[model samples]
Target chain A: MLTYFVTETNWLNFISSLVSQYRVFGLIDYEGELKWRRLNEANSHSITITKYRSIQPIKKFFFPVKEEVTAEPSAQKTILIGCKNCDLNHLKTTDSMFVGSPVSDPYYLKRRENTIIISSDCDDFRKTCFCTSMDEDPFPSKGFDINLSPTRGGFIVEIATKTAEQLISVRKHYFQDPQPILLQEREKMRKRITELVKNNNSELNWTDPQRIVSSTYNSKAWDDDIASTCVECDACRFVCGTCYCFILSETKDIWSRIRTWDSCQSAGYARVAGGGNPKNTRAKRLKNFYACKLVYRKENFGFYACTGCGRCIEVCQGKIDIRQSLAKLKKLEKNV
Target chain B: MFKSPYKSIKAELLEVIEETSNIKTFVLKPEEKFSFVTGQFVELSIPGVGEAPFTPSSSPFKTDKIDVTIMKAGYVTEALHNLKGGETLGIRGPYGRGYPVEELNKKDVLIVGGGVGMAPLRSFLLTLLEQKEKFGRIILCYGSRTPEDVVYKYLFPEWKKVKGLEIMQSVDKCPVGEWDETVGLVTCLLDKVKVDLAKTVSVVCGPPIMMKFSTTKLLDVGFKPQNIYLSMEANMSCGLGKCGHCQLGHHFICKDGPVFTYEQIKNIPEPFA
Candidate 1:
């Protein structure tokens, strides 16, 4: 519960000073949208804390899209800033996948141990946002080294872990006693974010994701509603926060085998060498995505694989909205 | 080359019989002792090649040796076909839940198998023959694409010597000179056997299509789904449950089952679908 203040005007200087002492990364403007980029002391002035989540998950930093898992590990000390609650939650899911078994993945472990994370509050919401339905707030309440709450005139920062305490000591000039007025301003921001999420509930209604999964087992709604325009490009899986399907490929015939992400949406994902695919139809494949996220992952891993990050909505080429697909599945349940 | 659930035992290949153009049977004996329950499978590996799961065709009571029958269907099996006698290879496991022997107590057993599907069931047949006095009548129905594909061809006379056991074999066609049994599908043999459905246990294994048709025929004869068991074969990279490749929904074929009763997973979508 350690609190401090950084004025809105000097927030850039505060971030710049921290960047000089630590390897820092933060959300920055990429083209027109926000994405994570390396932060240097000179460019910290341009970093934004308002975007709820980036287009790519923080996983790109932890587990790269394609990494040499078999190579000798080399991970640099780094800090990731501006991570949202949903992004942090997805990282926890990846943690177990990397660390759960005796054959722990050294590639993920090397980066995880050496990196520190600083999460900022979600001060705004997008039309596609629905973290509330997934029971996650846009803001991170815990599981962060440092928590930032944006206020009208300044930022209310709370140090969470010992790593954050070390960070605060190096930037002691930015600290000020937490004033009641600034605290009130941050509370109002939190309230507005919650209200925006609540108001957006109708757009995300899917009539209980569990029933949609069970009833759509052999439903024709998949072909009729979703499959016609699928194109099978695998964009949905790429943008998903919890899709962990990978194919371990032999690389360059020399360096060790590497696991690359594969999508159930792809035509070849489930095929064996002898050319037998249990899931062959587009309808069958689309149904698998829902089943994996809502039923199979919960039954096996005890966690809903989807964090409602809404990245899929932004990336789909067919204009397929995941929220609408679930809603349609819910409506088709009665006919089944 | 890769870690598997069972440790490698130094074993020599006693014989390799070309059962068919695409399948062969290797009879192996470990330099040391290795014992397993009937109906359990072992992981066989060839150095510099991959590993695959194969059930021992020989009865488990014969501890000094193991006989594995393999079909050259995929990567590892192709490597297994090239190995000669006295070559060193890895072996692990006798894993997965085997046949429920207790449930077969005093009950007539119907063993249905197709082509190389007889490999695992052969272990059960040999064990049942040894303990001939414990069970009711034993009936074996085996079918293959041709007479040449019918495995364990030399053991017919020995099995016939058992008083209460019946072995009915069929080939798709006799191929001119080999005409000693019925023709057409193996399900046609069900007409000749009499069974009390409530007091019978049936084990069927084969290619997915054969198993599907055999199971439907068995159910038509009033066999309970719980009493009908089937073996599932997926490309298993790791014999342990660590790898997700062998998964059928939430169940891993390597660990949860290579053998599962129809009642346990009748409703799981996709592979069972």
Candidate 2:
């Protein structure tokens, strides 16, 4: 509820100042695609507030792809920016994984404790975006330390919790009381944001989230749905926000053991040691993708693992559109 | 031993019994006494290799010693085979719900085992024998691939001498000069044992395919699905259920089970379907 603003001209400079003092991670152009990359003085000027979720999810910042969760020591501190609401929703799911009972993962705990999340509003929704259908708005709800929204001539800022207030206190002069005109601009921008989200959702109404769970279990539609083009390359899992299946490899040379990110889409993801794979077929693997996203995760963690950021669709070699697949599943269930 | 959160205790191998050509039984005695109920399993770790879940084949009554029979199917078991007496290993549990022994007291017991699956069932049988006066009748139907694959041949004769206990073993194919038991499938031996379906509880342990067929046969013989129990195995990388590797639908085969009743899991797809 504590709101403030920064001038549009000084937005990049403010980010640069934050970068100078912290190990900042900001949205950077990785070969023309927006991804969260390590930010430094040289890269801070090029960082921009993207209108859509990045190609990689926020899990990259928390649960790194190749991190040793049981490392002898642990990881380092970081501050990240330009995260959209869809990304924040996915972070809440990842929190349950690393922080599960009996013991907390030291590696994930270190990285999480040291990282500061700076969430921003989506200035534009991407073409494949369906976050609204997944109950995710472009604006963050509660978990972020600081929230940012763009205004006509500047950026509207809000601090939610003590962590954010402490961060803003580090640079008090940049803070200012809100002028009435600036307050009015934020109200108008919020309305515009809602309208944009509503329109995007209507366009995406063809794909249904509710049916993604109910129909994929034993449907013949999925046999054709997960076409021969799947290739089982596992790029979809790499790009997904909540695909947390991992394999434990013994690296006794360094440590007792290490668990690394494993993709369910891989041929051997569910294979036992003696070579029995329950989800061997592409159809079963495709079904697992839906069940893990819509059913198992919700039943276990009370949240849908998919944020509808459309990264899986963007990265699939098979061009398997998740929205289209869910729509097909809905139609198939209706026929039944 | 008293239970504590993630306690690492040292245990020594008192004896090693070769059960089959590729499987061995490591009898461990902890420096301190530890007691557990039947059907509960412990996490056995070889310092350099990794940890795996296995049930103690020894009786719960004998707290001073335990036996863990392991097949040489994976890395952990391979390391376990190389260990000798006085070698130290780490243990984590007597975790998950053990067999419903309180509910099972004073009732007839039917045990079905195949391959290395006999290990856990043996623990249940030994525990039952300690309370032999409380139970009415105990029947064991065990099967193996061939004569060379049979487990614990030394204990069969002593078990046969136990009053009111009927043990029937079978081999898929018996070799020459090594034959002395009923031949054919384990299910075929079911006809020989007289079980009053309503008064008995049956526990089955085996490979998935064998368990599936055994369940069907038990049902045909009028045993209620709820009266039957099954010990299931999965790749339990972390026995606490946080790892997600051991998930079967909503249940983690590690925590929710390595033992589950047929009625509890019949609806889950591909769970021994």
TM-scores for every candidate against the unseen true structure? 0.80, 0.88
Supply the TM-score of chain A against the true chain A for every candidate structure: 0.92, 0.92
Error of 2 at B196 (Å): 4.4
Q: Candidate 2, overall lDDT?
A: 0.77
Which stretches of candidate 1 lie above 4 Å from their native place? A1-24, A39-45, A67-78, A92-115, A158-177, A180-184, A198-201, A251-256, B1-17, B26-68, B74-110, B122-139, B155-166, B175-179, B189-201, B237-245
Worst 10 residues of 1 chain A by lDDT: A248-257
**Which ranges of candidate 2 are over 4 A from the true structure?**
A8-17, A30-32, A69-75, A179-212, A252-255, A334-336, B1-15, B28-38, B42-51, B60-66, B75-97, B102-108, B131-137, B175-182, B191-199
The most accurate candidate by lDDT is 2
For residues A31-76, what per-residue lDDT tens digits would candidate 2 score against the true structure? 5678777887788888767566788778876676664444354456
Cα lDDT of model 1 by residue, A1-336, tens digit = 788887866667777776766678988877647888889966788888766788878876766777554456778888887888888878766775565443456666778888888888887766677778777788888878888888767788889888889878877887787889888877777878878876887665664576677877788788887766787888888877676556544344332445566677877665553567777788778778877777876676776777777888788788887788887777778888
TM-score of chain B of each: 0.92, 0.93
Q: What DockQ does each prediction reach against the true complex?
A: 0.19, 0.35
Q: How does residue B193 of candidate 2 score in lDDT? A: 77
Spell out the clash pairs found in candidate 2. Answer: B1-B34
Report, for every candidate in turn, its global Cα lDDT versus the true structure: 0.75, 0.77
Model 2 chain A — which ten-residue stretch has the worst lDDT?
A: A67-76
Shares of reference contacts reproduced by the candidates, in order, are 0.09, 0.29
- Native-referenced DockQ of model 1: 0.19
